[model samples]
Target: MTDLATPGSAGLLNGKRLLITGVLSDMSIAFQVARIAQEQGAEIVLTSFGRALPITEEMTRLLPAPAPVIRLDVTRPEDLERLPLEVTRHLGALDGIMHSIAYAPPGALGGRFLDTPWQDAATALHVSAFSLQALTASCADVLEDGASVVGLDFDASLAWPGYDWMGVSKAALEAVARYLALYLAERHIRVNLVAAGMIRTVAARAIPNTDHLETIWRNRPPLSWDVSDPTPPARACILLLSDWLSATTGEILHVDGGLHAVMT
Candidate 1:
């Protein structure tokens, strides 16, 4: 029998230097990723700002490796522009980037899809989709050749209830991942998105009618899904960031407990 804790299996992310964003609380997927990455021997830098910074600082103490926090508000141009320099000073170089940042105004979600204004929709697209481009570009110089970029995503093909314009933003995020993969191919940088099941984080719980979505999701997947269990998606992100997925790019790997495949 194989020992699951052997270095080969356990240190899949050994020596990888990554920048992880979007960690708001311990319940977040990004928080789990940061913790697991450190456990697997990876070095990480976390990003946060404003009121969220204090919370993320408290979270850093929970990781095995001490991750330094950086102030990177994706919407702020100064923050984006200075990222490369800051990361260089902090981590020297980046082997991977986990784009966990995404936001949509309340008006853009919670069943306001048809009624959402252009401004709200624009905010969603810009923050949730375009920011990927901005973040990657800002870190391009520091990204080592063969760097892997993974973004958190939800199924954008289906019109999800209560998600509204955020659904459209996720779709745009998918397209952006594809284009980034194509453009970065020359540099040997790979980009992919892990389409995850609805996890009960602060963001998900904020959505209106989420209880209804969660009820259907629990019974729908052939392989059982727990709204609280983030292991599957977090593991998928680690796989993408490691050398194990050297040739996989522009892909959407579903960590949704087979719900997407079985749903009619």
Candidate 2:
């Protein structure tokens, strides 16, 4: 197991203010990123919506410092419109934003690709792909010059057995990041993504045939891939959020233990 550094020991994000979304539980990648960001000296505000709000709120208590949770349902136009004021009320101008949100309904995932209804597929694309644009644009007024935007991603280059509509959504996400990077460049804002290997998160477990995907990662990567631990990808997110990668944008940094490079 790779040892996670003590929070705040590195100070990589010292004095930064960030808005992080998609933290449903401690097991989530966003949770770890928020935890480490606080340890590294960032003041972060988190977002959750509806029934999951309380769950995300509870997870914040486990962070190095408890962060305030704001309600944001990306699919709701009202929520997106109010996001800037809500975020500004908590943390003034943002230095970074973490786009860790994605979802596909039961009807859209788990080998239901051919049988899935158009509504189900559209919902998946709207929530998983277009939400990045919605969230960023909503927060644009509050984003500081040179702010960084990082989104979590699964490799969409090849189809995984049961990934289904979520796979299509991810490909859309990559394209969105590139366009955001191009347009946001005028403000010196950087937009990038981290394509990660499977980790045993609540979200990952929801995808069908995850066991098969995990097995492939375990066997193919040149480097040892731990599906149990999320530290590596969390660290990559922190790096992108920091000033160290000022020149990098519209890029997908793979923290997938070399599985992305090896052909099966």
Candidate 3:
């Protein structure tokens, strides 16, 4: 939607302030999104917790202009309550927020879908889904009335090899996005998701039977795709965050090489 002719061009997100979470490694999609967002002129503030903070700080150096890292443990009420202050300390106000955080205990994933205890499943939902609501509320005062909120999503309409409880959590996340969109509508804020295809990130490796999962994707995608390439989804995110998609909200933009369209 940006006037820039070439994709990934500069100035698309000019002068915007963005808060990005779940940037734990260089290979993470949030990391690429942050780098591209900064290249497009958005001032980025990345969030990390205890041990991950120093590593995330190290990752920031790789950015075009190193962004400051902030402490935000999504499950912590105190952390969520104080996010606005920390964000304002570095960047005055937020134009967009990208929620890329998700986690499931080992018992909740793998082939233990039914065996996972309620506590684990609940933890999955709280961190992977409910945190979106918590985050939006915590940052509400700073988020502009017309600001955009985007989250990373996996297609949860169907089950996957080892995604297990995380798959259920993603389904909850989809619903969470819809609800957030409705709730934020009156405020002129936009809430949407990018339901991404498989990418070989740290989180992906934890899932069991990834090789089979990759096979299904490789054979299914209408457009050629690389499991290692995150640019497509990252680009979609920046587009949503930019003024280009001001009219769009409560939508799921699938960046999976058109795989979801195929019935087989």
Q: Note the Cα lDDT for every prediction shown.
A: 0.89, 0.92, 0.89
TM-score of each: 0.95, 0.96, 0.95
lDDT of 3 at 228: 86
State how far residue 147 of model 2 sits from its true place (Å).
0.4
Measured with C-alpha atoms, the lDDT of residue 211 in candidate 1 is: 92
* Inter-residue clash pairs, candidate 2: 8-39
Mind giving the per-residue lDDT tens digits that candidate 1 earns over 1-264?
Answer: 221232224587888899999888777889888888877778899999999999999888877657899999898999999999889998999999999978898999988788899999999999999999999999999999999999999999899888889899999999999999999999999999999998988888878888988887788899889998777798899889989989999999999989889854
Better of 1 and 3 by lDDT: 1
Model 1 CA lDDT for position 109: 90
Clashing pairs in 1: none
Look at candidate 2 and tell me the lDDT of residue 160: 88
Better of 2 and 3 by TM-score: 2
TM-score rank, highest first?
A: 2, 1, 3
